[model samples]
Target: MQEYSIAYAILAFIVLVLKNDIKDKFFFSLTFILITLAGLFSYEWKDNFTAWDIFSALGGSSTIALALLALLGYLDYIRQEEEVSIWLHVKDDKGNIIQKEDTNFSILRKNCTRQELQGILGVIADVPRYELASIKESEFMKDIDAIQIGKKKKIAIIVSQEKEAYQFNSIFNNKYKKIEKLKTQTSLRIDKDSLHDAKKILNEVGMNFSEEVNIFTKMIVTHKGLSFEVKIHNDEVNDLTDKLQNALKEVARQSKEENL
Candidate 1:
């Protein structure tokens, strides 16, 4: 029994290390065969070996297999919890909570037209390595607009001007049809009063105007197969562009890492 336990432990280790290389069907078939063989070898062949003896041996083997599976599950759960603690709630030395959280920026000036906002965002979206896909009005909301960009790594630009403020958003994804493992979102809000000066700075930087009302920008990123949400806020159009580019780069990096 000791030898059998040692052998099972070794087998479990191999499974854990090469789980990606082993197919599910092959692993299950191998497990069934090994368990059956273990049961047969352990059974004592007395003068009249009966079906009950075989059943007892198989049941004992099954109990050990189930225990091993439970142990693996517990280990995986512990690993996940540790990762969440490390990655999900990161903070700076000042305890400022530097990790992913919704951020807000204040914009104080006169209101601008939606078209003008869209043009400014269009220039911001013009980052290196990413091509503009589409610039069109949103189908759902009249006041809201969108600009689609990128090919292999796609980003959906969401701009809204429903109330008196303006908003700029960028949603990053790997696929055109469906969003896969990695996604990152960034949103910027300009209050009603700030639009005039916001437009001026953005225009001096080369202004055009357009916007969303999401109070916080939600950026979702996957690290080591674990997904978490991050929020960021910035005051300038250049900062907004930098954030978008950074997000696109992050999504690209994660996709490459995961081979998605």
Candidate 2:
């Protein structure tokens, strides 16, 4: 309290530099000061001048550092937040993705008009000779309007031209409760019919499922952003799973022979 010159300057500089968090972090600090005059007036504790003098000596540098520290902290506080992750890893030799692959997420069952699902999948190939063809065709209700609802869904599935999507369509079309797909792969959505059936089956055939399965078989619908998934299994529900599997095996066998 002997001199307020240096104290005032340091305070001013900090106020300017840390104009942002000043109001919040002020009384937020711990500080104790002994006035030389007050101590001298009191006969009890007049010997603490040494500590005050030491702090006063380093006062300018400390205040500058504190202000700089606050500014840096503020920078980090408001720094652009990173995106929530939506990624999956496949470790097979041919499946290691070196970089993000170009993906086209289709809303096959969700926003899909029968016309759209019909467009590419070729009129839901009947479950006849397809090995795992769905026998529960009567169960799949046609909720053609499920996609346009105000609240959107989060779903995940590996997309390839090969089979799974087609298999489900072939097996469960017009039978299972519904098929809902995300509008953009960016917009995660799940197949409700499959999800329901899978959940029921999960409880019934507990030990039959993969112990290592990571995605949801039954998802609790919530929207804190990240949840994308699909159910994977072969059952009576799969219409063309048998045929598709056999055909795929044949293709693999032929390619191996050609290489020889």
Residue 222 CA error for candidate 1 (Å)?
33
Candidate 1, residue 132: how far the Cα is off, in Å: 13
Q: Which segments of candidate 1 are over 4 A away from where they belong?
A: 6-10, 23-33, 82-260
TM-score of 1: 0.29
- What's the CA error at residue 237 for candidate 2, in Å? 21
Candidate 1 C-alpha lDDT tens digits along 103-146: 12111111223444344444433233222212353431232211
Range of the 10 consecutive residues with the lowest summed lDDT in candidate 1? 145-154
Q: Across residues 5-77, which tens digit of lDDT does each residue of candidate 2 receive?
A: 4434444554456543334445224111222222233223335557665555456335544554566456434
RMSD of each: 25.4, 23.4
Clashes of 1: 21
Taking all chains together, each candidate's TM-score versus the true structure is 0.29, 0.21
Which candidate number has the best TM-score? 1
